[model samples]
Target: MPLRPSRDVFITCAVTGAGDTTGRSDKVPVTPEEIAAAAIEAAKAGAAIAHIHVRDPETGKPSRDLGLYREVVRLVAASGVDVVLNLTAGAGGDLVLGSPEAPLPPDPAGTDMAGAEERLAHVAELRPEICTLDCGTMNFGEGDYVMTNTPAMLKAMAARIRELGVRPEIEIFDTGHLVLAKWLKDQGLIEDPVMVQLCMGIPWGAPDDVATLSALVQNLPDDWIFSAFSIGRNQLPYAALALAAGGNIRVGLEDNIWLAKGVLATNGDLVRRAVQIAEGVGSRVLSPAEVRAKLKLERRW
Candidate 1:
């Protein structure tokens, strides 16, 4: 893709990620009500979209509970906010190996594998405006845990999401992931104007660096709309970087928990700050309506 300057930017606030960070930060929304409230707060504070991942409220751990997802969607809808919903279909693919010495049983406590249909049950039922499709398998995080999303699984999930009239945000963790995403698009599994998110600074995926970002950006289809984000401290800087690279931005507690050193941040605060960065860089922050029009998103609610 030829790099062009951008004057308009849309921010997607990833409300709560499926990570083990609930105990690390008091600001991370845990319950359905809390998550919905945070997402609404972000939208009100200038987030074009809210990227959500439901958790087991009591356990504060990642969950695939269909009921939890339903409630979150209900609460967000009841708020009457205009935030575009981007629910995650990336859960239930965790695989923690037993051990290098043993390597069996798959550690039931750490492994949470599910069928493709089961992983997307909530998305199918709720029919959010946008849902994510993790485009490839990778060794996510540290240790023996692998994030498993096979070709067949992604194909099925992408087809189902299209049938539900929801846009699938293809998540690219590395260059290979982007290639796979393009292949999916070529196979007609994904619609035109493919929306992608470049997940940077992941432990085992792409690193948070300029050369890597440039490589990924250059490989992307010119006509596709893309966003770039990094985890932790890199998240804030990526707001400017993504725009400069002719893409959108994503930020929230899912990628970072701090506004600064020793200071916690909220979803609204992150959105507000991201808006500042984009505007400061001479880019107009786009509203939800603008984002929908640009992405050709179908809002059912």
Candidate 2:
């Protein structure tokens, strides 16, 4: 069968990821209310899905607290927006090693690894339409830090997510990660019509270039549905590129912050601009219901 023409492009706004970005910008939502409001705004501005992550309310640090996630979900559910909720199952895997001298001890200030069940506590309870599963591990920038997601852990999490009746949006940072994702699908750990997110331009992972993007796209399974996005200035351009290459798109503060140089951006603004770009390129934006139908996503609980 010939590839389907990219007409109904869906945009997912990553409202606020579990990162230290809260401290850097006042625009980053910290509390559950703020996060939920931001997600609503993004949905109103044309995002079909809202990718969410909660934080410590007091310190504004990334957190895996299930209560925080629950509150955010409740608020969004009450807001009456029709956006699909995609909770982050990508936390609790940070392995910040100690000084080279004391690597065995694992610095308390840095390390935050947890068991599989503990990591996915929120996903099990909240049961969003979708939850991300980082397919593999990689050195995630400066500071000798590693985003640890071993194959064993991935299989375990994938099984749990499937049991919860939540679709796993497999996050692939590199070609090798995609390989592992394919392996998991082959082993029946993941389901058919697999959804993937091509995370590009992170430190020490896939480069943000056409060659790399094309290679990743070419390697995907025939029936899989996927989306792609790049960080910073590459965000808008990559939207067009991804759609033209037969995929969906993602945008928001989790990946990029500025609407323009020296200008801060809100999640809604970022999403709106992406919508404009998609429309300009002869593609129609998909609503939440449309996206749910397109990706076979379950409705919110």
Candidate 3:
């Protein structure tokens, strides 16, 4: 495929990820109400889509409670925000080992492995327009915590996502993850115009440099709608890079907490910065309806 930059773009705001970010930043949404408010704020600012994850209201820990998800969905719908909803199915794959010397049994405190159907329970009920599918398993960071998504598990989830008429945002963390994505497509699991997310600057994964981003963007199959974003300080800059790389943009508290050198950012702030970056470069910011058409998302709203 010839290199073509995206002049028409849509921004997805990852309101509050399941990461341990609540204590670091007060702006990071914890409760369902706060999370929905942040998504609504992003929508009001300029985001076309809100990528969601629910957390425990009391402890502010990441949770897979169906009731919590329902509350977030209800709040977002009630807020009258016309943003496309993208729920996460990456919660139950966390595998924290007990020790390197004896790695037989996983740590019960952190490990949250579950069956494919259980992992996607929220997605099945909420029926969001989009949900993430972490394409490959990798050591999440400097620890025994492995983000495990085996081949069999992935196929089962992909098939179910297709059956539900909800688009799966294939999350490519490393180069090999992209290869796995192609394999999934070849297996006739994902549909045409596949929506992909090139996650960059992650530990033990792909770097956030222009060369790495460009290489991945270039390798993407023709007609695949991709969005790219890096974590931490690179998150804001990745917006411009993604627009330049013929892709869409994703930003919010989930990826980064800083709005500037020392200032903390809300999801709305990150989204506004992304909007400025997109519009400043002459890219037309797409709306929710336009995103639905471009990615062929089944509208739940």
144 Cα displacement, candidate 3 (Å)? 0.7
Candidates by lDDT, descending order: 3, 1, 2
Model 2: how far is 209 from its true place, Å?
0.7
Q: Candidate 1 lDDT, tens digit per residue, 167-240? A: 99999997899988988898898997799999999989999899999999988877999999999998999888
lDDT by residue for model 3 over 79-107, one digit each (tens)?
A: 87799999999999999998899887999
For model 2, how does the per-residue alpha-carbon lDDT over 1-301 read when each residue is reduced to its tens digit?
Answer: 1234478799999988876787667999999999999999999999999999888889888889889999999999998888999999888898888867877777678678998999899998888999999999999878768899999999899999989888899999988999999899988988867999999998889998988988998889879999999988898888888888788989998888889989989999999998998899789999999888877887865
Off by over 4 Å in 2: 1-5
Worst 10 residues of 1 by lDDT: 1-10
Work out the TM-score per prediction: 0.98, 0.97, 0.98
lDDT winner = 3
Which residue pairs of candidate 2 clash? Answer: none
For model 2 the TM-score comes to 0.97
Off by over 4 Å in 3: 1-3
